[model samples]
Every structure is written in C-alpha cells, then in structure tokens.
Target chain A: MRPLFVSGLCIASALGAGLEESFAALRNGTSGLRPNDFEPFPHPTWIGRVDGLESAPVTGALARFDCRNNRLAQLALAQDGFEQAVARARERHGAARIAVLLGTTTSGILETELAYRRSAETERLLAARDYAATHGMFSLAEFVRARLGLEGPAATVSNACASSAKVFAQAARLIEAGICDAAVVGGVDSLCLTTLYGFRSLELLSAEPCRPCDERRDGLSIGEAGGFALLEKAPGAKAAAALLGYGESSDGYHMSSPHPGGAGALLAMSDALARAGVRPGEVDYVNLHGTGTPANDRAEDAAVHALFGAATPASSTKGWTGHTLGAAGIVEAAISVLCLERGFLPGTLNTGRPDPALRSRVVLESEQRPLSRVLSNSFGFGGNNCSLLFGRAG
Target chain B: MMRVFLHGVGVVGPGLENWAACREVVSGRAPWGEAALRVPVPAMLPLTERRRCNAASRLALAAAEDAIGAGDWPAVGLATVFASADGDGAVTHALCQSFAAREPEVSPTQFHNSVHNAPAGYWGIATRSARPSTSLAADQDSFAAGLFEAALQATLEPGPVLLVAFDLPLPHPLALMRPRRHGLAVALLLGREPRGGALAALALRLEPEAMASPLPPALEALGDNPTARALPLLALLARGEQGEVRLGAVGARQLVARCEQ
Candidate 1:
C-alpha cells in the first residue's frame, strides 16, 4: 500500500501555538508545565495549561458552541497555515468530500458537569442547547465539523489516550475505502477539574512536572492540547511527512495497569512495523507513551528494549507537553512528523538522572540525528495500545 | 472490495441472557429485564480473570465467546473492534469521585476499567491473539458504526473480524441524560462466509423518508437494550424473514441488513 502523506500539519499546545513556537520550546528543552491555574481546584497540581482561553474571541456561530475545549481547538487550527490548508482542501476536493475525525476523552463534559452543579432544578441540569452540544462525546467532533464546514463523515474516537492516534487509522481507512479523498485527523482536550481530580484520585497526577523514564519519576502532569494533520491520497504529493503504518492491540490484562511483561505493547509495536513492512533497525526514533507513572514507564521501557534493542534513540515529549491524555497520540504524532521534517529529536526534559532500569534502553536527553522513519506510541488505560509510524515523504 | 458476512452473534442485556432468551424477548415471549446483570463470557478467560473484568468488558467477552464458538477464530491478522454509547461510566464516575474526595488513592483496577477498549484488550490477552484491536464510540448508533468499522477492517485486512457493542446505565445524576436498563450486543463478521450458517450483507443507505416519529421505536428499543435488536433480527431469520430490513435514524442514516437463506 502507498503511504498516506500528511500534506499539512499544525499543533496548538501548552508550549504555545504554531510550529515555530512549539518546536522552539522543544529545542530549548523548556517545559510547558506550571502550577495549576484553572480556578475551582481545591489544591495545587502541576498542569500543562494553555493561557488566555477566557479572553479568546469567537464568531457568532462558533461562540454559541464555544467552550474551553473547543477554544483550544480553534487556536490550534488557526496556527501553522492550518486554515489555509483547509481552504486548499476545499478547493481541491470540495467541502463535502473531506472528512473530520477527532479524538477526545471528555468532550465539553466538564462544562456540562459544572452546569449541572449550578442548576436550580436537579431534574434538568442542562439547558436544551447545552445538553445538545455537551451531553454526548460527539460534541467536540460536531463543533469542529460545523466550524470547518465539512459535510463528509464527521466522527469522534474516544478510546482514552489512544483516541487521537487511532483517528489517523480511521481516516486512513476511510480514504483507502474511497469514502473520502482527504481527512483532518487530530485531537483536542482541555484541563478541567474533572480530569485533574480524576487523575489525582487515581494517584496518577504529579505535584511537579513529570520526569518520564527517570529514577525519581513520581507521576504524570495532566495537560491540554489540540493537534491536526491534513492527510491526502496523493501518494506522490509534496508533503511534510507520511503516515507509514499503525498497529493497535488490547492486553486486557488489567483495566488500568499495563501487562507487566509488556506483551500487549510488544504486539502493538510489532504490528505497526509489520504493517509498514519495516524492520526494527529501520526505525530511527521512538516517541514513547511514557506517562511517568511507575507501572507505565516500566512497562513501556520493557517493550521498547525488547522490540528495538537499547541502541535506538527514544524520548517522551510528555515531559514538555504534560501527558495530554486523549490528545497525547496526535500531539506526539505531530511532534514525530515535525522531527522528520526538522531532523531534530526533542529531548525528554526534567530527567536529571535516568532510572537505572531505563538507562540502558532510554534516551534521557534530546539529540540530533538524521531520521527516515519514526514510531510514535500511545497507550491508554484499558491496555489499548497503538503505534503509528511516520516517514519523510519521498 | 471483499464481501463481509455476519455469521454468528451473542447478546446479554435487559431481559435476554442468551440467544434463546433473546429470541423469546424479541418475539414478545418475554418482557425486558427491569435491571441488567453482567453476563460472563463462556470460557473466554480463566475464572480468576473473569472475576476482575468490568461490566462492559464481561459482556463483550461473553458475546465474542459465542461468536467465536460458532465460527473459527480468525488466526491471521484478525482485527477486533468494540463500541459503546457510554464507556465504563461507572468507573469514570468513580475516578471523578475519588478525585473530588482528594483521596490521593485510586484503584489501579478501576482506573484500567475506565478505558473504552478494556474488553477488547482483555479478549486479546485471554486468547493470546496478537491481532490489532480497536475500541470505538458513536453514541446511540454505536452498533451501526461498529458494523461499519468491522466492514472497513475486513476490507483493509481481509480476515475474520470481531465487533462488540455494549453499554450500561450510568449511576444517578449522569443517568438522567438517557436513562435505560443495561444492555450489550456482539457480532462476528468474516470476509467470507463460515462453513455452516446463514449469511448477511450489511450496507448503509441515506433515504429521503424521514421517520414519522423522529425517534423510531426500534431506535429507542435498541438504545435501551442494544443486544435485543440483534436477537429480533436473528429471530426473524430463524422464522424466515427474508430480503433486507432497514433500520434508520432521524437524519436518514440507515443500516441495511440483507439476510440470505
């Protein structure tokens, strides 16, 4: 099968908007995480939050459906010549021929939750408009589709952290099946009390910026981000990056923790390579699903070592991005594509001393290297693991 | 494009616990269960593993077990796609409450259960199958979407594909959104028809006819007891309902079921 090239790609993350801003932060090894600033939180926890959301402006139609999450998406979509790319796609394929697939865990549910709490009548916690927009997981996708004026298939993938990464797979299948000629695949998630408290309850939230693959790594710092890519079927098209292949697997070993042996992780990596028809040696770098949790880091480390050997350069951008949860997949995938486009691998910040167990297999700091193919990993809570492979467009 | 066939199915929801029970309920021989019970998949995993599975995962496993028992498990490059309207709501709610209490402690078990694909992952582990699996969600049309994804997967990787759709009612305040009893439905599809069984070709058609009742009874029934919809269709097949049956949503999005004798 020919590669599905990413003709245009953009990211709006905590580090800042646009390719230059985000890449500059990665190159400088700056962490986007900071003390929690979102009001309503009872206690302080580190977060990767995008500033100036409350003051962000929206038009009449977009305003009616606007919320913090969609606002984050709007900002990201406006960066890196993204709007121009959409306009070009509209001219090339017609608006109805393009599809929109977004991945998110909580789609405006935070706003709905707040509304319910403030409702005078418990029976009707949500107003009709709010209920229509925020009651379901499809709200985020609906908002984007309407905003972009996309008439083709518009859907949401909510498989936890792997949500956005799998959006690529869905979009690819849609194109391969001749359903759509082009697709916008990405994810958007915002920092909300619900996610912050939820992870805190699970003891998975760190008080400090997460140090992935480090010895003293405590837990993950939840963050918010939105990333998008324009995938076209023109195999010969000039492109920034090409999606080589993707592999997905479920360990079903546990609900929250990964299999100790990393069996499922291994399956996902191997499947992705097999689909790409590339050997492990061909992979130049791996973007790991390193959440900094004790269980997660260990399992991911084991899988990486077993698959690519210890010599393959690998790093977790989560140190800078603060584990964007559902948005992690697409965000990291976008970063991986950027690596192929820019030829510099982002370092795993905050790893002063690497975990002894990971020292042999992990890349603790950033390094520059010529990269042809990069494998990005996104593993979610339910042992749902996905590995997406990207290569420089030929 | 390869033709995908729906060979075998199993469902556990509301008043129906098995294929026979589903047939009875769909044929009006039984009333829907006021409350839902988690049905364990037969021999899909060890008893110990089964004990740890969540309600959605258990229902999916049970349905996959029935589907696989009826047909051979696709050995090479099979893909698993699981869908639900509300994914692990109880576990998500628990996670939220734990955060609200500032407990700084969460059950690793519950945290894992919160994933949408937990059931598909568990099935792969138990089967020791390394094929790629996906967990998907699309609100009330989850079943139709699952079927579409399964068909798409079959087209991409031509093998037997397993699709499971299940959702349980939320606890309290969350339940007010669309309160209903618990339900689950499972269907197994193959690129080619299995040795013995009826075959069905699934297609999607956008019709001009708007539903007289914007919300169709079939849609409501399926939403409340998704597994029950499969039983009625199967019972119709058992009773010789031929040709195609069209189930549509308000916007003319319809799933066309073509059953062959």
Candidate 2:
C-alpha cells in the first residue's frame, strides 16, 4: 500500500464543531456524553448528539438533500475549513479527478420516519418527495459530492460500523489504481429513530454515559456525527500524518454479536500491522473499538492482549463520542491522527474501574506522551472488522 | 496496468435466472418479458440462515451461487463486495412501521438483518467464509462501483474475489415514493488468473465514457434496477465478443471493459 497522505480533516461530533473544540475537549479530559434529548425513547440512556444541526441549513442547489445526516456532513465540512481545503484540492487534482467515499448506517432515515407517519395518515407516499433519493444508502455521498462540487468517482459504504474506516482503504485503492489523484473519504450518520430503538431491541444501548472497558459497562451510548479527510497521492509540506495501512476481516460467527474470542479482531490487527510495516512494540497507542459492551470489550481485550500484551497504552474514545455507528471509523481515525499530532494518550472517560481481567493497559487517565504510530480499531455488525494504522511521515 | 479475467458470472433478473439464461435473453434469442419481480430464495443458504435473509440478500446470494457453480468457493481469504442502490428496503419499511407502532420493540431479527452488509454476512456464514467483505451503495450507478472494488481486490489480494450487486423494491409507503419496479442481482467471480471454471477474459480500463450506442428497450428496462446496470457488459461477455462496452461511471470516468473470448 502506498502512502496516502491525509492533507486536511474535520469532524462535527458530540465533542463539538471543529478540530480545535474537539482537541481541546480531549486535552482537558472532558466527556461529550450527555443525557438523551432525542424524542420517542422511553428508556433513560446517554447520547452523543451534535447540537444546533436542525437549523444547520444546506444552502443553494443542495437544499433539497437536506436531512439530519447531510446537515451533520455540512457542519463538519464547514468546520476546520474542510470545505476550503476541498477547494484547494479541487484546484490541485482538478475537481473531476477526485473521488468521494462515505459510510453511514441510518442515512436520513429520520426523514422517512417523519414521512411514514405523515403518509400513514394521508395514505399517500408522495409527501416524502426526496425520500426516494435521500433515504437510500448512497444519498450522503451524493449529497457530499454535490456540496463539495466534486464530480469524481463516488460511493457510500454502509457495512454497519466499519463503513467509514473502510472508505480510507477504498480511496487508497482508487488513487493507487490511478483512477483519481485525490479523494474526500469519510462518513456521516445522524440521530434517527431506527438506531435508538434498534440498539435497544438488541439490549445494547447503555442507560448511562458509555464507559468503555469498565468492568460494569453495560452497552454503548449511541452518537451521531460526520467527518472527512482529504487524502492525496502526495503529502503536502504541511501534511502531519498518512494512512499507513488498514486490515479487514470478518468474524463469520454471528450477524449481531462479535466473535467471543476476538479471532476476527486479532486477524485484522495483525494484517494492519503487517501492512503498515509497524511492529507491535512500535505502536505508541491503540484506540480500541470498545463500544462498552461486555462481549465487545472482552473480546477486543483478548485480541489486544494477544498482540500488544499488557504493555501498550490503549483506550476506547467511545466514551466521548458514543458509538457513532458508521461515522465511528472516520471520527476515531481523526482522533487517532490528533493523538499523533497532539502528543497524548486519551483516557477511557467516565469509566469508574477498568475491567480487571483485561491484560492490555487500558488508559483510564489522560496523559501526555510522545507518539509516532497509532492503531485505531472499528468493528461492525455482521462481524465486519477494520483496523487502521496512522503515523507521521518520515 | 493489469488485465483481469472473469472466472464466472451469475445473474438473476426479471425474466432470466442465471448467466446462461441471461445470455439467451440479452442476445435477442429469447423473449425479454416483464419481470415477475419475485426473487426466489437462494437454496445455497442454510435453513438457519434463511430466516435472516430478506429479498435483497436472497437476490444477491442466488446470483453469487450461480457464478460459483460446482467449482471451489474457498471458505477462507475470499473477499466479497456487495453493492446495492437500495439496501434492505423491506427492512427499512418494516423498521419505519415499527417506529409508528405504540410500542416500538424492533424484532432482533429485523434489526440484525438491517445492515447493508446483511447479505454479505449471510454469504460469509453460508459458505463458512470468514474473509473480509464490504457492502457499498451507489444508487443507480452501483454496478460500476462494485466492479471497480472487485477488480481492485482481484489485482491486490492473493485470493479470488466475489462481487455481488443487488437491490429490491420496497413494499408500499416507501416504494410508492420511490418505485424500483423490479428486484435484481448480478455477480462476477474475478481473479488475476483464470481457474477451471473461467468464463471469459476482460481488460477493464477506467476513462470518461461518451454515450456509445443506445441500449435496446429490453436492456434499457434493466437500467432501472441498479444491479442490472451491468447488462451491457454482460451481453458482451456472454456473446464471447472481443469488443468494448462501457461499464458506466466510477469516479470522473466510466469503466470501459474490453471483453475477449
């Protein structure tokens, strides 16, 4: 895999609007987790909702595509001058030579839910005008491409949680294949009824702020977020990090549940390490895909323990962002890059006590540290697993 | 830089069941009629896994089975790419209705099967293949995207790649809003080297496509369903012709497949 340099990146998550806000929150050990305000759920659970997005309008021709998900994408793109960065990339690669790949689970499904309720009363589906276009899985990527004025190759990955992370690899392949010179790869998933209730049906939504790796952690705190990174074939002089390598594997054990032994996770981690040419001893830190679910954390611990043992500093940042579903990959990837750039090991916030049986050193406290290489893991439903390695260029 | 050979092809569309049947219809030898719009359940799936599959999953798996045939489908290291314009519309519709219910307790089965990769997951379980798989959506242009990803895997990975693109019309409320009209799926088994069951060879290059020849009405109907967007290329491959047919758009360009017998 050639070095696909990340030229610019931004995220609008529960942590806040831009890179500075998110970085500052992480640096100060602040948890973005808050009590639920999303309607129609009876159970008391924590959520990582991005605020003021309802009024975060998409202007001009892109207005018809507006939904919570696309709005979040717009918010994130506006932050950190990501939209401006894209303009420069378009100038560099020519707008037609860039690709757009995004990931999302419930993309604009909320609009459909609203439409469904209206149609159920009217007995007509025409009320949901753009439902046919936006509700489909590819809507976000199409909307983002239009918003950024990119005409290159485009697609949306919706492999549950690993969606966005896998886009990085996809972008790398297309560029390496010479199909494109640069790409905007990321994911967006906004809050919707399907996920809030769906996770509850699976009994996987924590009632409290998610405490990843905590012994008493019950389930994940769902979050909505959008994020992006501009990956170019050549690194700009100011480029801080590059997508070193990525490993993908499937559990094949269960559709919803992970492999109890973390077999797939281990395979992905090893493959990513081998691909990145980084050794276990060299990884400065690992951002675990700790959803705070008992089975997920324990299984991931087994895999992490097998690779890095109890030595490498590791933590699950889900505590801050909740589990952003499809956006988890890019959000955490951005955070991992931030960790490499900012020089710190982010602690597993809100955890009272780390799991006693885990062998890996779970970072329960924020600490300053020099870092070179970091591995961020994202595991999704259907046992889809992806491990991404990020590092500073030599 | 590399010429990828197509080992096997599978297809399930309105009136055709597999590549052999699809070839007959696309070659103008058989009457191309309106689709029954009914996708048969994939017999390759185990009984336990059957209940977990929806129309889209069945459509995808059935096409994958046709492409795989009696040859070996390695249970390991086979990367799968599943693409769809509309993913699990049935589940989306059901989930939406559930939200309307007084007590919205989504069935665990529906919830798990709702992922866009549901068919891909079932593919892993049915074949006992724990290899990596990705599910992507490109709306109307999914076939081109799926082919691009599959070809990339074929060139990069050591193992053979399976590419399945499928989609199905949603039940009312949603379908009335955005009607797909037909349920369809197609598959291609690709590898760097042709194996025993190899069908035809092809060199796929990516470039901007000028509107070449207009599609015949029968084939034009195929375009309405995203998976069926591969019909033009499929016609060329099935004819065993050594000519080029545009595989539609990818990035800023289209996939120009030069098929060879």
Candidate 3:
C-alpha cells in the first residue's frame, strides 16, 4: 500500500480546540472532562464536552445546519489552518478532485431530540426541521463539503465508533481508483441525548473520568470531538507523517459486544501491519481503543498481547478525550501523527495502574521518544473494527 | 473512471420482490403495478439475531442475501459497503420519542440497533463473514456513494464486493419531516473479473451538472425512495442493454455509470 501523506490536520477534542492546544493538554496531563453539566437532563456521568458550543452555533450561509454536532465540526475546521490546508488542496487538485468523507454516529440527531420535545409541548406534527441538512446521517459530510467549498464526491460513514476511522480507508481507495486525487477525511460526534441516555441504558458510562485499562475501570466517559486530515498522493515533503496502512474487519459475532476473544480486533491489527509491511516489533507505540469498559479493555488487551506481546508501549488516550465515539478514529489518528511529529508517547490517562489481569504492557506515564511508526485501533458497535498505521514521512 | 463487473443483483421495492423475480418487470417485458412493500424477515440470521433487526436492517439483509446467493463468490469473504440515506428511522423516532416523553429508560436493544451499520453487523453475523464492511450515508445519493465505494474496493482487492443501499419511510411525525413515500433496497455484487453470470460491465465517472436518468414510467412511483436511485442502473441491466445512466449526485457532481453487456 502506497502511503498517503497527511499534509494537513486539525482536531478539537475535550482537551482543546486545535492541534497545539490539544497536544499541550496531552503533554501537561490537563484533562478536559467535567462532571455531567450538560443541561436539561444531566445524566450522572463524567463527560468530555467541548466548550462554547452553545454560543458558537453554526451561522452564516450554513446556519440552517446549526446544531451541536456541526458546531463542533465548525470549531475543528476553524483550528490549525485546516480550512487553509483544504483550500490549498483544492487549488492543487481542483474542487471536484478532492472528495469529502466523514464519520459520525448520531450526527445532528440532537436537534431531532430537541424537536421531538418541542413538538410534544406544542401538540402539533413534528415541525419541519431541515431534516436532510440538519439531522441526516450525511449532514456532517454535507456541512463539511459546503464549508470547505469543495465539489467532489462525498459520503459519510456512520459505522458507530469505527465511522470516522473508516473514512480514511474510503479516501485511500477512492484516490487509488482515480475517483479523486485528494480527500478531506474526518469525523465529528458531539454530545447528544441519544448517546448519553443510550449508553447509560447499556450501563456503559463511567461515573468518573474514564480510566482506560485500570483494574477498577467501569465504563467509558463519552466525549465530543471533531478532527480532519488532508490526504494526497504525494508525500508533502514537509508533512509530519503519512497514513502508512489501514485494516478493517467485522467481529461477525455480536452487534453490541466485541468478540470476547478479540478475534476481529486481532485480525484488523495484523492486516494493518501486513499492509504497511511493518513487523509487529516496528510499531513503536499502540493507541488502544481503551474505552474504559472492562470487556472492551480486556478484549483489546488480549488482541494487543497476541500481536505486539507484553513489551510494546501502548496506551489509551481516551483518558484525555473520553471516548469520542465516531470521532475516536480521527482523534486518535491525529494523536498518532502527533506522536510521530513530537517524539512523544502518551500513556493511559486517569489510570494509576494497568489491570492486573490484562497482559499488554500498558504505559502508565507519558514519555518522549522518537517514533517512526504507530498503530491506532477503533472498534465500534456492530462488531466493526478499524486499525490505522501511521509513519513518519521522511 | 473506475470499472467493475456487476455479477449479481438483489432488489426490493414497491411492486417488486427479489431481483430474480422482478427482472422481467423491470425490463418492461412484464406489466408493472404497485403493491405494498413487504420486507421479508431475514431468515439468514439466527433467531436471536433476527429478533434484533429493525425494518431497515431487514430490508437491507434480504436484498443482500439474494445478491450473495446469486453471485459467483461465497458471502464469507466478500467485502461489503452498506449505504442508507436515513438509517433506522423507526429506531431514531422511538428513541427520540422516549426522551421527549421523559421516559429516558432507552431500550438497550434499540440503542445498539440505532447505529447506521446495524444492517452490516447483522449481515456479518448471518453470513459469518469477517471481511471488512463499511456503512455510509450520502443523503439521496447514498446508492451512488455505496456503488462507488464498492467498485473502488473490487478494483483494489481480489475478491468480490457487495454494495447494499436501503431506506424506508420514516414513521409519521418524523415522516412528516422527511417524507419518504416508500421502502426500497438494492444490492449489487461487483467483482474485478467478469463472472459467468455477470449482468454487465460498468464504468463509473463523476461529472458535474448532470442529472440522474429519469425512472421509467412503470418505476416512477418507486423513485421517491432514496435507495431507489439504483433503479435506472437496474433497469438497464434488466433489459440486457448497453447504455449510460446517471446514478445520483455526489455533492455538486453526479455519478454517471456507463453499462455494457
């Protein structure tokens, strides 16, 4: 697999609103999680809510698409000169030659939830909300494309947690197939009632900030985040890192639960290594999809142990951002690129010690080390799994 | 442009059942008529799994099952791309209604079933396939997006690829918002190499300022469903004719598919 350089990237997570701020937070161990403060129906769980969304509503020509999710997306797009990077890519490869692919689970369903409540109050038919533009699963992609002023082929992957991560794979194939020369791939999932109360019903929410891989780990701390990467055929000589390879697979077991044995997780990791032509030993760091759930951490530990053994330096950055759901893939991908660029390896945050039962060597503290390659894993509901390998672009 | 061979097809729409059963009707040989859309329960799934399916998943899996059965390759190893314009509308409506009513004890089953890839997940379990599968949405252009993704995968990899595009009318109130009039699903088995039962060779390109081919008069009523955007391409395949048709829009560009038998 030929590497596609990530010439430009931007991220807005619980940690901060751009690459620099988020990276600084990661370096300084500044957690962005707070007790449930989301208003009107606050569930008793920690959340990684982005700041200023209420005041930063989507405005201007795209105001009709206003919602928490798109606001998060707009915030990310405003950071790190991502919009400028996209503008450059558009000039280099025409608007129609750059595809827009994004991932999100609930998207603007938050608007729908609010709309439903309003309708119940009014006792009228569900009022028309620009359903397609605001609440549709493709709304994130549509908003991003229109915001970026690109006219390329576009689509939105909604495969749960694996949603945004899979967009990278889609962009790679589209470029390889000559469907597009470049692509703006990213994901955005904001705080929504569907996920909040939904996860609570599943008993998958941790009362404290998520402690990934901790022996006492209970469940995930849901977070809102958005991130994007510009992928192109040529390795931007000055680019910090490139997408070396990606692997995708399904559990074929259960929809809600991961395969207890981590069967699909192991397969996706192995495939990523094989495609990148990198040996397991070459993966200097591993980004675990440690959502802090006992089953998830344990299952992922088994898979990582089988592949990288007990020696690889691995950690779950979820402690920093909570589980960003559909945005997890790109958020972690951006973190992986940061690892390659800054020579830093982030340890699992919020966890004091690795689980006694877990076998993988869980790094408990952030460290500085030159790294050439890293693998990030994102597994979602419906048994969807994706592993992306990034390497320093020489 | 990207090229792929259409190896098999499965379709379910108003007045249509499966691809094998409706090919003649689509080809203009048999008289077309409207009937209530009945999405068969996915028997391919085990009982436990079947019970978990919603209308969207059932419609997608039924079409996928037929396409996989008709294709040359086994279902186990083929990659899949599932597209839905509106995913699990019924579930979304239910979840929102529960919250709206302040009865926030959302059903665990409904939460899991709410993911857009629920059908792909159910498909994986039914076929017991570990092959990579993706679920995407492109508003009304979902079918074209799924086809483009599938064709690209088939061209890049060895095995056949399955593309499933499906959508059902949103339950009212919500339906009052989006207004999809019918339920429809279409699946295509695409392979890089021509198979013995190949329907046609398709070349896909993205063009600006193009419109999707108008549905035949007989199939016009089905066009209200977003997934029915596949009807034009299917109609061409049904007649065993060589021609070009626009699949649908991708942002400001349109996907133009040229079919040759």
Using lDDT, give the best candidate's number. 3
Q: TM-score, each model?
A: 0.88, 0.97, 0.98
Residue-wise lDDT of candidate 2 within A289-354, one digit each (tens)? Answer: 999999999999999999999899999999888999999999999999899998988999999899
In candidate 2 chain A, where is summed lDDT lowest over 10 consecutive residues? A119-128
Listed per model in order, the count of residue pairs whose N, CA or C atoms clash below 3 Å is 8, 2, 0
* Most accurate candidate by TM-score: 3
Taking the true A–B contacts (Cα pairs closer than 8 Å), what share appears in each candidate?
Answer: 0.35, 0.72, 0.85
Better candidate by DockQ, 1 or 2: 2
TM-score of chain A of each: 0.96, 0.97, 0.98
Better of 1 and 3 by DockQ: 3
Q: Each model's DockQ?
A: 0.36, 0.68, 0.76
Each candidate: chain B TM-score: 0.81, 0.93, 0.96
lDDT per residue for candidate 1 within A1-394, as digits (tens), equals 5589898888888899988999999988888999887756765678898988789955686666677788888899889887788778878887766878888877666655554445365446543435335646666777777777776666678778988998888888878888678988899888865677667767887888898988999899999999898899883247979999988876656556788888888888898889889999999999999999988989888888899888888888998989998899989998998899889977778888888876335776677777999999998876678889999988
For model 1, which pairs clash? A250-B121, A252-B121, A252-B122, A255-B112, A255-B113, A256-B112, B15-B33, B41-B62
Per-candidate interface C-alpha RMSD?
3.8, 1.8, 1.5
Candidate 3 C-alpha lDDT tens digits along A1-394 = 8899999999998898999999999999888898988856656788899999899989889998888899999999999988998898888888988999999999888867877777544224345578788889888999999999999889999889998888998898888877688999999999988999889889999888999999999999999999999999874337889999999999998888899989999999998889889999999999999999999999999999999898899999998898999999999999999989999999888998778999999998999999999999999999999999999997
lDDT-based ranking:
3, 2, 1
Candidate 2 residue pairs that clash: A152-B251, A153-B251
